[model samples]
Target: MRLWAASVAICMAQAAHACETALLLTIDVSNSIDVAEYRLQVDGLADALLDAEITDVIVQGQSALAVVQWSGVDRQELSIPWTQLRSRTDVQTFAAQARAMPRAFVLSDTAPAEALDFALRQFADAPACDRRVIDVSGDGTPNSGSDPRPMVRAAERAGVTVNGIAIESMGLAITNFYRREIITRDGFVITARQHRDYPRAIREKLLRELSRILG
Candidate 1:
């Protein structure tokens, strides 16, 4: 009985280590976002994770995820630590944590460059996985900090894919900027027609990111 238990524990430990992807979700909490908008972003993310298709992919792939709330140069908080989604319970727990998480910043400028830099550093502590991705969602382009192009290049060189979700509340300016300067060569961008459409866009993005067929 003792030998059987030991064997099972070893197999479980090995399975836990076999993650297919490490995904870091970076959300913008700049001053441009009103309180209502912030709530939408937060709730939308939680809802996206709960979507049936998204949850299915997460469980099947054993994807590890983390969330960062980013704004100004000095404002980037790890809202949720890395959590592996290997089962229904794990997905439910992650969604609950995301829904309950508080906003990290309220009155800061948009600084995509600094946010990207901070996100890159996060991968150092990520679990071993087949892919590393940073999914940055923002409603504005960079208004402060260094240029993000170089950092985007650096991320690509480090074998990390940086994708983007552009909230088009202010028009396509942010979306164009993300396409040209933010997303990596192999990464794709999702466009939210407005802040209200964030949940749908996030669901699609998560599905693509977590699915083996699309990934």
Candidate 2:
């Protein structure tokens, strides 16, 4: 019985060491996010990915990340492919690559629900990740395309956690709407208190989320 207990302990240790987690990050590039704001948010996200503290928890080849930019309607474009965030160097490389990605398309209206749908499809076939998450950022409520309710429900069903980073320089009322209508359990929302503080808010929020997800 003693030998059996030791064997089980070893197996559990190995299993824990071999665990890998996958996470997806989505940014809004819709019209509401003006040109200057767009650059801030995009580059802020890139910086967050590079932060040492955020990458410290990645277990070698066992952790991965992917990024996508979403615009009006269902236009979700991949910014970076899934990559093993093994070391600080890997984090730097990934952030550099993301920073190189352009705004790609102009914005029209907010369609967060569509972004969720596209993210679901993009990540559905990813290798069996230990913990899967969809980190999304947006400024306004849904104004175009499909409704967000069904897709949000589907994401929850698939064991994917949905976190929101709502830019709220506009007001608290809109942010309140997002908190209620969207965002999932075990998830969080970070706000850009003022339009000028968007970059800082996004970077801080993303780094926090990365830490939580990897932990």
Residue 97 miss distance in model 2 (angstroms): 1.0
Cα lDDT for residue 164, candidate 2: 75
lDDT top scorer: 1
Expressed as tens digits, the lDDT of each residue in 1-215 for candidate 1 is: 99999999999998866899999999999999998888888899999998887888888889999999999999999989988888988999999999889888888999999999999999889989999999999998888888999999999999999888999976688889999999999888899998999998888888888774232
Q: Candidate 2 lDDT, tens digit per residue, 1-215?
A: 99999999999887655536677888888887788887787678777666555666654535678888887775778878777666677788888887778886684777888888888887755656667888788878888887777877888798788877777865675567667766776677777775666667766765666566422
Cα displacement (Å) at residue 71, model 1: 0.3
Residue 92 accuracy (lDDT) in model 1: 90
Give all TM-scores, in the order shown. 0.92, 0.84
Question: What TM-score does model 2 achieve against the real structure?
Answer: 0.84
